[model samples]
Target: MNPDQLIEFLGILEKLKCNTRHNWSTSGRQESVAEHSWRLAVLAMLMEEDFPELDMNKVIRMCLIHDWGEALTGDIPAFLKTEADEKTEAGAIESLLEKLPVSLASGYLAMFKELSDLTSEEAILVKALDKTETLIQHNEAGSETWLPLEYELNLTYGDEVCRHFEKTQQLRDKVREHTLKIMEEEVRGHREK
Candidate 1:
């Protein structure tokens, strides 16, 4: 293993600390991509019981690196991402992988590709958890980020989840209900005033 190459890759990952998500945290500060990934990884572990057949370790690793591309491409909001943006992110992932040694790079890149393609049950579970995590955060934080959207939630993730995981569906529905209730209260308060 090339220590220098590994260090360089680690340094690039540090960018995730500054790449902020569109949604604010419960503390009212914009959460970074690194913070988002960490929580998602934790969620993957916590939700492992729901999918006993899948590899929880692989799910956790996917959660950790799924957003590593954002370390190079920056955190683009799911709703605003375009096909072109995805292409850009794919390229960024490849570029980042090129910086690591062959042994580490091949494994990490394969994991990234597997998750990107939803090639395995573990990958699919991780993907669902990723979306669930965002929605969970929004519900917990009462983020107004989704208030102006014409849809109930961001299309990029909202539609993709729940198709594969029952627990994900439950959480998605809960978040939707929570968001609607919050909006209704705000509207009613405005009318009363």
Candidate 2:
């Protein structure tokens, strides 16, 4: 194991604790990427009870590192993502992984790739939970924190996410209901002006 290189990777990861997401907290401060990942890991552990068949280890690992690319690329909201953005993020992840010893780096890259590909069951669950957690955070962050997607939430959370991971349907439905309500309020306020 290349301890020095691994230490460098860890140092780089420390930046995530300070790298804020575009979404604001109820306190009006931007949420950090590390905060998001930590909560996602907690959710993954608790969610294991709901899916006894899948590997929780894999789920937790993916949750921890899924956004590591954002350390370099920043948290590009899914609605705003483009093929070019995706390519850039992949390149950033590839460069970061190069800092580790080959064997360990391969394992981490494989885990990250699985989430990117959304091919395995565990990867799908992590992805769904990631979205669900975002919805929950938005809900808790107050009405002022309404979703900003140009498209309807139903299109992304309902038709797309649920179609792939049916288990997330309930959460997606709830988030959709809340987001749509807030969105209407936003429109009404704008019209009154």
TM-score of each: 0.90, 0.85
lDDT string, candidate 1, 1-193, tens digits: 5688678778999999999998788888889999999999998888878878888888898899998889988988887899999999989999988887788789999998898788998888887778878877776676454556733564335646566777778776776777677778768888999
Q: Tens digits of per-residue lDDT for model 2 on 151-174?
A: 355336534655465556766777
What RMSD, rounded to one decimal, does every model reach?
A: 2.1, 2.8
lDDT of each: 0.81, 0.80
Candidate 1 matches the true fold with a TM-score of 0.90
lDDT of 2: 0.80
Clashing pairs in 2: none
Question: Could you tally the backbone clashes for each prediction?
Answer: 0, 0
Error of 1 at 86 (Å): 0.9
**What residue runs in model 2 are displaced by over 4 Å at the alpha carbon?**
147-151, 154-159, 180-193
